[model samples]
Target: MSETSKVVLVTGATGGIGSAVCLRLANSGYSLILAARDISKLQAACAALDRPGLPSHRWISVDMSSDASIASFSHELATDGTVLDGVVLMPPQMRPTGDCQPPADMWRQLFQSNFIGPLELLKSAISTMRPDPSQGRGAKIVIISAITSVQALGNYATSNVLRCAWLAQAKTLAFAMGERGIHVNTLSLGGTLTPDYVASIDLRATKAGVTFSERLAEETLNIPLRKYGRPEEVALAVEVLLSPFSDHMTGVNLLHDGGFTRAY
Candidate 1:
């Protein structure tokens, strides 16, 4: 990558939404550092994003749930001397508890994976970022959250708590980092048809003794758009937030929910 090219580190880079974001950013001329737990998947994602004329992209293995892994990754990031420009943080993988009162151990695990670990990683990422307003160089941080963060989902108790924590943290960081020319924002998503989500809908359909299309139609009834979002649509929204178009935006929680979020 050229010295002047912007470098963004995208966590969960191999997931549906993450890979789409990588492609969008790469096409827009940003070099990427793809971070994920699986090396093979990371390699595949990096290869998919690489093209003849685009800036090179690389991958690193880091388990966001492990403190040791996060520390090691942070050390490597700080010493690599890469002028980190931005970060797109995808929520950690989690299973639905299906009840509000989960075990204490589950609470602890979710907190570490969703709240504490991401906070530590962001601290390290911010340390490596060099933002200068006068030079037209600034940093962006986009935290990808779920609609559970904004509304209550009976089966996603842990996510409801943790994602709300993420929103608060993003808002706090926006105030804390704004003076340093870093824009921190959150994107709350709803019912995106990712592979995992599709599987979830399939499970629901089987449980309800209905066809997939029937279950899916029921799922979209509450959404004003009457459809789930596409991963590429998410990528477009992320591109705007990470670009100069959102230079003046910070502490903003943008909802990409097909108008499913009814809160004022």
Candidate 2:
């Protein structure tokens, strides 16, 4: 662990992929700024982390779906004299509710939370990342996208659209942010076996009148790896995007789908 403790914030910190990133960065010696709307869950997650020889974490109540909440959280970070070193944006785990037709509100919330909120966080924290153009050190922004964005999902149209938009947004922001040494990129993922996945399976089971495992198994079959992903595996992808190894990289979208997306 390095003594130079830089602040790294992770949104949706209670989820599978997000929590894995949270733990990975914490173990790597970064002081974390964890955010999620649920205070109890956030606190419990913080307590559960075994920092051992790593830096402590900071938590803020943030609802990415609400612009007001995101703004307040950013403001609080700004006031606390903590500048950002890295950011990992994770969207909420959303599933289709039988209509197979995307709801307008679902699209709205997903777009805001998945794309807009993170963009706002980056914009608000830009000054902190790029203090002086002379000194090339700047913050890094990493987004968690889905492999399904490239491959169409039968019922998850909201994700199909919102995730694509988010990747585009990341590219745009990357080009704009690169000059100051800030790095921006995305990790498009495959199936992850998170608690959220379990919840979605329950819904699928209820809808199909089947057991949860049966529903989950059906969903997992599409993944080329023939299994759901572990959160730590996704975290490793995030780590590479965040590290100095990727300092030259920006405006790039990397896939971590275990060959699920066959088309390059």
- Residue ranges of candidate 1 with Cα displaced over 4 Å: none
Q: How many steric clashes between backbone atoms does each model show?
A: 0, 0
Residue-by-residue lDDT tens digits, candidate 2, 1-264: 346788788888987777888888888777887888999989988877656777778689888778999889888988877777888877766665445566688667767877777678767766566434466576788888887667777666677777888877888888877777778888888777777776767987999999977887787687677777779999888888888778778988888876777786
Which 10 consecutive positions of candidate 2 have the poorest summed lDDT?
A: 127-136
Span of ten consecutive residues with least summed lDDT in model 1: 91-100
lDDT of candidate model 2 versus the reference:
0.78
TM-score of the candidate numbered 1? 0.96
**230 Cα displacement, candidate 2 (Å):** 0.7
lDDT tens digits by residue: candidate 1, 1-264: 666678999998899899889999999999999998999999888888888877999887888789999999998887878778999998676677787888899788888887888888888988999899887778999999988878888878888888888988999999988989999999998878889889989999999999999999998999999999999999999999999988999999999999998889
User: Candidate 2 regions off by >4 Å?
Assistant: 1-3, 50-53, 97-106, 131-136, 199-222
RMSD of 2: 3.0
lDDT of each: 0.89, 0.78
